[model samples]
Target: MHIQQLTIENFRNLATQTLNFHPQQNYISGCNGSGKTALLEALYSLGRGKSFRETQTRHIIAHQKDFYRLIAKIIDDKAEHLLGIERQTRDYRIRLDGENLSGLSALADLLPIQMLNSDHFALIDQGPEHRRRFTDYGLFYQDSRFLPAWQRYQYALKNRNAALRDNWPDEHIRPWHHQLSQTAQLIDQLRQIYLNDLEARLNYYHAELGGLETLNIRYHRGWAQDKTLEELLIQHLPRDRQLKHTRDGIHRAEWRIYAQEQDIAHYFSRGQQKTLLCALILAQNQVIQESSGKQPIILIDDITAELDPKRRELLLQFLTDSGAQLFITSIEALDTPKNRQHFFIQAGQLTPQS
Candidate 1:
């Protein structure tokens, strides 16, 4: 899906604005604090159903403004659709084609977006939560069974943890254990299959960046790989009660990346890490397109700041060939020639440049 127009008001320092956008590529350029990133965030909120940088709505609403509003006209193969959102301090209202939505997932169904910023390389350097989010976001778009299985697993885990904390007997917690094991097994199997599909794609893209093909990412099922999840969950029951938490399961699973048999982020340079993360994200993006036949709107914030000249060219070339609609922001305009809808952002204003 692609956004044809965006209307934003009371969002950060951005003034009231309604702007038309090209379907293929949109370039937003301005100096720092000129509302370049804010415009991107305005569009991002419509897709994600929340602000990209802030948890609370009040943090994103302009000073002295009670609320912020955004509207977007999106087009897909089926038809054109309208999505809108308005947020107060803690609550939000969302609409699709004039009808209200029950939750943000409904909006996400209309427009799936992927974003990358300066801190995006943290996907490798940070803790397991980052990798889990990366895995789930990609699977959420591709695997319909993923969400329900994840929900069931989470529910079972919560109840099971409660029993452990309360010192419940084995029989009392066995039922929840069974549920957790069943769901975790499904999650684990699906994740492995998903990664298997992505392995070749990851290698191909990483090699395209002129990096050596020494990438190896493996899914480590939190317990032992040899044993079944149900068997292992029961085996861990004794220690789990002592720890008062579910410690060994798919919930604790991790995706370990290795570069030339050495761990990622430890041996790789800053540019290499960014390139690796970009390949991984783009590989997942390719999986989404392969499964859904729709390329997600890609929000790239200040991409040139982090990469060297050759790596930057490689990344830009890869993005250009992806056929995905792009909304890229930068301090100064790059030398890209394929994009037609270019704008300069100065003090929250968008002036068309080409």
Candidate 2:
């Protein structure tokens, strides 16, 4: 999917404006605090329901403005869509093609976006939540059964946890256990399949992106392999009751990255870690494109930071070859042949240079 036009109003430092976009490449340039990243944040919010930079709506809205609004004209699979979002202090509204939508998933379905920035390094440096979320993002687009199974598992887990917390009888807790075990198995299977595909693509992109060491990913299913989820849950019931929550389940599942059998975080330098993260995201983009046959919009903030010229060029080339619409921000305009349009932003004003 590609955006044809974007309209912004009262969003951060960006002045109210409407700008056209190229289908393949768009380079946004400016000095610090020039609202370049805010432009990308506006677009990212349309795909994801919230901002990656700030979580609070009060801060996201322009100073003294009651709300912030974004509207995009998108082309996906040869059809045009009008997507709009309006965010207020405590509420938000979304509309697609003139129809009011209830949730953000609809927008995510239509506009699959992959974001790259300094904060994303957490995929390797942070805890299991980040890695699990990374895996689930792919699974959400790839597997039809993932969302429902995930919802069911969450529901069962909540009820099971409550039962333990409230000291419910074993019979009452057993039913939730059954539900949890069943859904857990399904989720575990789907995640494994998705990870297998991701690992293969990750290795391919890692090599193509000039990575040297042999990289591997190991999956932990949140329980001993020899025991079924049902067995594990049964065996851990007493401890779970004592702890007032189930600790050993799919919710605790994690995946780790390794370079030649050592953790990448320890083995790779800061730059190498960032490069590997880029490869991982690019691999995700490729997997989404191949499985869904819909190209996702790629957003990169501060594309030149930390990355050396050679790696940056390789990253840009790979993105260009993927045929996905790109929105990249830099302190100064990059000298590149693939850039089709350039926009300069300063102090809330945006001017198209080409």
Candidate 3:
């Protein structure tokens, strides 16, 4: 799937305008504070339902503007569809093909997007929550059963935690425990399958990117492997009561990356880490495409950060070959072939450059 055209209004500092896009590749260049990233943010919001840079609606809208709006013409499997979003301070509306959508999952399903930027390095450096979210994002696209099972699991976990906090009797909490155990097993199975695919693809891309070390990933299912979640919860009941929270469950599941059996952050340089993260994201995109036959849109903000010219060329080549629609931003125009469209932004205005 690819975006053919995008119209923006009152979004950040970008002027209201419609910009045409190349189905395969687009390079956006501009100086700092010139709204290059804002352009990418608009596209990301259309797909993901929120901005990566800012969370508050007030800040996302332009100064003195009441709301922000984005509309895009998307092509999926030879059919064109219209997707639009409008956000006000108190509410927001999403529409696809002229029909209103109550939620963003439809948008995500229609337009799968993978984003890479300096902030994404946190996927490696941050805690388990980020890693779990990373895995879940791919699963959301690959498996239809994932979301409903995940939702049920979250609901059970919430009730279980509440029961524990309230000092409920064992019998009262046991039902939630059963629900948690059943849903957790399913969630763990789905996550394991997805992560195994992710790991295999990640290593392939790592090698393709000239990585030498053996990269490995370890997934902890948040409970002892030898024991059922029900058994573990029973064993930890006292601790749960003392702590006023459920102590052991899938909520604590973690997945970590290792290089040569060492933590990646400790074993790899900054640039290597960034490259590995990019490879990981690309591998994820490949998995989604292979499983679902839908090519996701790839967005890379500040493609030059921490990457030398050689590495940048290598990454860009890989992306171009992936056959996904690409939107990349850089401070200066990259020296590449002229087949793709190029645009320069200044003071929130965009102009195509020949």
For model 2, how does the per-residue alpha-carbon lDDT over 1-354 read when each residue is reduced to its tens digit?
Answer: 799999999999999999999999899999999999899899899888889889799999999999999999999877999999999999999999999999877887888888999988888888899889888888889987988899899999999999999999988998887788898999999999988888888888888878888788899989889988888888899999999999978899999889888999888999788878889989999888887788889999998885788888888889888898999999988874554988899997889885
lDDT of 3 by residue, 171-268 (tens): 98888878889989999999999988898889988887778777889899999999999998888988998998887888899998998789997889
User: Candidate 1: where is the Cα deviation over 4 Å?
Assistant: 165-171, 336-339
TM-score of each: 0.93, 0.95, 0.95
Clashing pairs in 2: none
Q: Which candidate comes out best when scored by lDDT?
A: 2
- As for TM-score, the candidate ahead, 1 or 3, is 3
In candidate 3, stretches whose alpha carbon ends up further than 4 angstroms from where it belongs are 166-169
Better of 1 and 3 by lDDT: 3
- How many steric overlaps does candidate 1 have? 0
Q: Which of 1 and 2 is ahead in lDDT? A: 2
Candidate 2: lDDT over CA atoms?
Answer: 0.89
Put down candidate 1 lDDT per residue, 166-208, tens digits, no spaces. 9999999888877887888889888888877777788888988
Q: Candidate 1 has what TM-score?
A: 0.93
lDDT of 3 at 345: 96
